[model samples]
Target: MSPDSVLVRWLPVSAIAEADWPVLSALLPEDEQARAQRFHFRRDWESYTVAHALLRGTLTRLAAAAGHPVAPPDWRFSIGAHGKPEPILPEGVPPFRVNLSHTRGLAAVAVALDREVGVDVEWLDRTNLTIDLADRFFAPAECAQLVGLAPEAEKDALFAFWTLKEAYIKAVGMGLALPLGAFAYTLDPLSIAFDDRIQDDPDSWYFQRLRPTQGHVLGLALRHEAPERAMLDAAPAGLAALLRLAG
Candidate 1:
C-alpha cells in the first residue's frame, strides 16, 4: 500500500467461526475486554468485541507492512479531546491516522499513512429512520432532499446521509461538538456543503461511499493537502483471512 492510500478492512461478525472468537477477543486490551463484558446482550458483545479486535489486527498489519512491526496487542492509542482515537508510536515510526465504525452485523477500520481519516458503516435495515428524524439531525437542505425521496428509497438515502455526516465528524475529531446539521452532503457527486459553524475547506476533503455488503452502507472521509485523489485498498471479508492477505 502506498503512503497516500487508505486501507479499509471489514468483518462480518456472523461469518467468523465460533472457535476463532476467543483468538480475536484475546487481541483486545484489558480495557476493551472489560467494556465488551459490560454489554448486556450477546449480539452487542459480539459486535463490540469484533469491531475493536479487527481495529487492532488492521493497525498491527499496517504498521508491520510499513516495516515498524508492532504486534496486534502491542499497539497503543490515546483518545483526542473530542474522543477520536490517536495512535501512539515510537520516534522513528511514521504517523498514521485511523477511524472505525461498526453496525449490527459488520465492523470496519480505515487507516491512512499521514492524513486524517474517518470511516462509518451502517446496516441498511435500521429501524425508525423517518423524515422527522432526518429533519432533527440533518441540515435543512438535506432534510428537504429526504422529504422528496421516494418511500422505497428514503431509508437508503437517510443512511447514506447519516454515514457521510458521521464520517466527517469522526475525521474532524470533534464528535458531536461538530453539529450534524452544520454540514450537508449531496449524494449525486458525493460533495459536501458546510454551514457557518464548521471552519473547514470543502475542497481539501475527500469522501467515498461503499456497499461493503448488500445490507450495509459504508462511508470514508479523508483530508489531503494535494488534489490527488486517494487510493482505496479495501478488504471486505473476514478478519482472519484479511490478516493473512495483508501480511
Candidate 2:
C-alpha cells in the first residue's frame, strides 16, 4: 500500500486526560496551539488538540513514506477556495491528500496517495436528534424515503445518509460548497444517485461503511476500491505502526 493510498483511522477522544495533555499539546504547531486555545470549553479544546496531533502525525508518516521526508512542523496546510484543507507540496512530489473529522469522543482521518479521498464518523446516540433536517439537505427522493420510515427506522437511515453525503462532498474537495441535496443515497444494496449537477462519472468513485468500534458509523469515499482500514494503537508511535499494518 502506498502511504498516499486510501486509509481510514480513528482515535478515541473520550479517554484523553489532564495527564496526557502535556504531550498532546506539544505535538501541535504554534497556529494550532492558538486555534486549540480559542475553544472555551475543555472538551472542545482537548478534542481539537488531539485531532490536530493525529492529523500531523499521520501526514508526516505519509510524506516520509512517499520519500519526501518533511517534518511534521514543516508541513504546510492551506484551505481551498471552497473550504477543504489542502496540503502544500514541495516541488516534484507525488500527490498526498487527507481529510479530518471528529464527533464528541472520537476523531477520524482519511488519507489517499494518488487519489482524492474523504471520511466522516458520527456518534449514533443522540438525545435531541430530529429527522427533519433531511428535508432541507437531502435530495427529494432521499428526504421522502427517510421520512416514510417509522420514527425508529427513520433515525437509523438518516445517520447513514448524512455520513455518506458528507464523505462524498469532502472527497469532491468542495466541502459544503456542494449542497447535500445534490446527491441521493440508498442503504439496502448501498449506493448513491448523484444529480446532473455533478459532472463526474458515478463509477469513478467508491464508498464504504466502516465499523472499527462500537457506537460509531464511519463513511469513506475514494476514487479507487476498498481502502486499508487502519486501527489506532496506544503505543507512542501509534499511527506510524498502523500505516505499516495498512501497507
Candidate 3:
C-alpha cells in the first residue's frame, strides 16, 4: 500500500450463519473470547465476534501479504488509556493505527498507511437520539447551526455534527478526554477549527462523510503528516471504491 492509501471495510453484523461461528470464533484471542462470553445475549456475542474477526482479518491480511505471515488468530491487542485498541505487531512489521465503530447491524473499520485514523458509523434512525443532548456537548456555534435548521432537517444535521465530533476525538485517541466544545466544524465548506486551546491544526486531517446505506451514516477521518492540495484527490481509486462495499 502507498502512503496515501486508506481502506474502509464494513461487514453486516446482523446476519451470521451458525456454521460460521466456530470458524469466526477461532480468530478471536482468548481474552476476547472471555469478554464475548460475558455478554448475556447471544446476539451481542455474535456481533462482538464478527466485528473483532473482521478487524483481525484486516490485520492478518496486512501481515500475510509479505508471503510468510502469522495466522490471523495469533494476533493480540493492547488497549490504550483512552480505550483505543492497538495491535501487537511482530518485529519487521509496519504498524498502523486503527479506530473502529459498530452499530446493531453494521460495523466499519478504517485502516490507513501510517497515520492515526478514526471512523464512526451511526444508525440514522434518529428515534433513539435527541437534539436536546446536543446542547450539553456541542460547541456553541454547532448548536446554533443545529437550531437554525428547518424542523425537518434538524435530525440530519444533529447526526452529522455528532459523528464528526466523535470521529475527531477518536482520532485523538482520548475518547471524550478531548473537550467537545473546544472545536467547531462547518457543514457549508466541510472545514473545522479548534478553539485556542487545542494546538493541532485543522488542516492536518482529511474527513469524509459518507452514507453507504440508508440505515447508516459514516464519518471517516485520517490525520495526515503534511498538508497537500491533492490529498483527497490522491487517495487510491480503490479507497473510495472500498467504501461502496460497506453496504
TM-score each candidate: 0.93, 0.83, 0.86
In order, candidate lDDTs are: 0.83, 0.71, 0.73
After superposition, which runs of candidate 2 have C-alpha atoms over 4 Å from their true positions? 91-93, 127-129, 147-152, 225-247
Model 2 scores worst on lDDT over the 10 consecutive residues at: 227-236
- Candidate 3 per-residue C-alpha lDDT over 113-196 given as tens digits, one digit per residue, 9 for 90 to 100: 678888888888747567778888888888888866787588777878888888888888889989889998888777788999
- Residues 101-171 of candidate 1 have per-residue lDDT tens digits of 89999999998888899999999888876678887889988887777668878877888888888898999
In candidate 1 the C-alpha lDDT for residue 182 amounts to 89
Model 1 scores a C-alpha lDDT of 0.83
What's the ranking of the predictions by TM-score, best on top?
1, 3, 2
Error of 1 at 176 (Å): 1.3
